[model samples]
Target: MRRSRCLLPAVGLLLITTACQGGSSEPPRATTPGPATGTARMAADSALRWSPAVVWSGDLNSCRQGEAAATRDCLTKAMQAGGASADAVTAAGQLSSAGELAYVTAWHEQDGIGVATVAYPFRANTNEGTRLIDAGGKRIDVDTVQLDDTLRADPGVQALLNAHPQATPFAPARAAGGTPLEGGGVRLVYRTPLRECHACADVGQLQIGYDFDATRHFVGQHVVPTPAP
Candidate 1:
């Protein structure tokens, strides 16, 4: 799924009073989105879906103000910790909006589908500029890359979710916490609904984890169902 400039509403210049998570894919509704250098290039099947977001707990107070390279660098780290995809983090630094923004919203929208907000713009000085970042951010091109299309189409993924007849088509990436994996490997997380729908306030959820060896080759997967509330 691709992020839309329209779906994202304007966020006021407010201090993020609540803390957001340290960039994770759990709680499928908490993914982050940001801006891209170019329009998103996604799989043909990707379509819009419902997404709700929460503020990340990571401290970005230092990032709240400043436009210097160092400040930007600090914000970059904040975004990284905030679960922004690698590309969105990089682009956050690269973005040179003509105007200055006021504050970064604590409640970030899920990017692409209904999971995370990789990149986004706080209602700055005006309504002239707004963009998307990464969360499931999109494709295998997310933090490292968006969820690989091959994986999304993987019969295995569908099979795993087969027990749940109502899983939605939406998929959002979950960023691994800041801690590093033991063997110098990488871990990726993603989630989807147990019931299918274009939009719903809440639905059954599932968590999917992917493990890769240090060489970046696929190792295995772990799927867990989010118990109904």
Candidate 2:
């Protein structure tokens, strides 16, 4: 298993203090039902909505820090430090939060092929930004609006929360990340501490799959047993 270090704030905020692991090279596998998958479908018709504006606002604030020009300068330095060519910043723009942290994303041409990178300020409160290059490093088409945001707002997610009120406390914070599907769409994941097992480190997660068009087509939930400290 791949191990990673993460920092969880009091509000259950998920933050990656170090470099993030690269994505899998293989294509996404088919969805298989797990023991917790049943309860994930408890509510199929509730209206739960996520606000892209809200997400964008948070993302902008993260990098901009109230000064647009300074944020641009930070991004320029970040891309340069990441070995990006001069033209990278030309097509780059601020993307929604990557892994829930503020980042500046830009596209670059490497050996005639297009690639994208997400850069963030270093952890030590420095002016430089560390870059997370995509695993494939393939040309990335920027989507200012992400499908995962829609998945978070899906009624199914709300329905799941209604079925299990305990999960409500972790609302918003429970939302982790979304992975793009092979066919088209994205898989939204949510992880929250188990209510009954307060003393245990076990975590319950709900994974919801949505089509490229933003339709929730699959729902699965499972409890991950705590790992050894």
Candidate 3:
């Protein structure tokens, strides 16, 4: 959710892959520590369930080195902190590449609860910068006003663009061949800057995309719930 510092690079980055369709809610009171269960659990109760928080990923020793075991361990700890049942934790899978990572964790109801998958793929470096393309097809450098104007021009991506303008197209925002994963699902592509984490600095060309149904598989495709204003 926090992406202000997610600016990666400006070129030559591969794309890759989620969990719930949307962000998870805050966990309910930590009274009885057990698995979530029952048909009611299908509702994704944030009242007692923690959202899928992002543990560290994208750094050299953290994830960039293609460390499956370390990556899995990091995500597992994150899910546990978010209150995942032991079984659900066991269902987690780690998918990572040169400039991408997909951390998956399963969830279930309170008592032998049904299971659902949650995945989040972090991408870096892209061919497209925040430049704007006019109706005449002229490209414009990224500036605050110009970027806003371009997004407003497109009805389809207007709203999403407004909401996540930071994720908009940028210079050097291109990708190579994108292959489908196991389920013949939508292909993913991404790009970012040289450095991974944006802890204090900016990550320029960060782009990412995933299959349509991925959100549904992870979080149930619908409007992800948001907190009160």
Candidate 4:
């Protein structure tokens, strides 16, 4: 084996050894930070708001069975903190699968539909700024209406809310002759899960009306029994 001698410099009794016969070992190759540098990756995923997971903790109480505005503020603030968007709390939506954790996840109500959160303005407000989106590319925002109907605890009526839960509120209500107005009547058409599948498919719709009085308070549910064939 052939050997090369490295030239050494000494200071006091210490020696600095430059062991290889090369001109600076390749200049350290200018490094460009990759996209996954821990901090950068974390910053990038902020839109999802996944954790401290604790940033996602707090009052996830049901908005059902309460004064509309108070219910809206309490639940929405908690849910938003818990990484839930307006849409995530709407229309059969749950914080965890099958309502697995927090307020809605830990409980159920009598004569209530377990569903995604849907909000409608109990009254009018000027919250027209766009701050969020839905599963679709279409843009929507969190407003009083979207906050109030947030039934974690959600369910909304058309033409009835100061604003509607649907992206297209002005579109005609799917229910025939049901009022979508505040203190007005509401009709909901829904299908019960035929089996115990949280993330499956089912078919069928049974509808009933929600009656409200002139004071805009929930009165009672009105059901027209299905006729046998």
Candidate number achieving the greatest lDDT relative to the actual structure: 1
Structural similarity to truth (TM-score) of each candidate: 0.27, 0.26, 0.19, 0.22
TM-score-sorted candidate list, best first: 1, 2, 4, 3
Clashes of each: 49, 2, 48, 16
Off by over 4 Å in 4: 1-99, 102-203, 225-229
Candidate 1 off by > 4 Å: 1-117, 121-166, 175-183, 201-206, 210-212, 215-229
Off by over 4 Å in 3: 1-70, 94-101, 104-118, 125-229
Model 3 lDDT tens row, 72-180 = 5665565567665544444343233343334434322211112223343334432122322222223222211223343244343344434444544333333333444
Question: Model 1 lDDT vs. the true structure?
Answer: 0.36
lDDT of 2 by residue, 1-229 (tens): 5432211222222211111115947433326654444444323112111111111111223344555433555554555566544334332333323422333343343222223344434333222221212223222222121223333354443444454444422222233455665555344433333232334342333322211213333322222222223
What CA RMSD would you report for each candidate?
Answer: 19.0, 20.7, 19.8, 29.1
Higher-lDDT candidate among 2 and 3?
Answer: 3
Query: Which of the predicted structures, 1 or 3, would earn the higher lDDT when compared with the native?
Result: 1
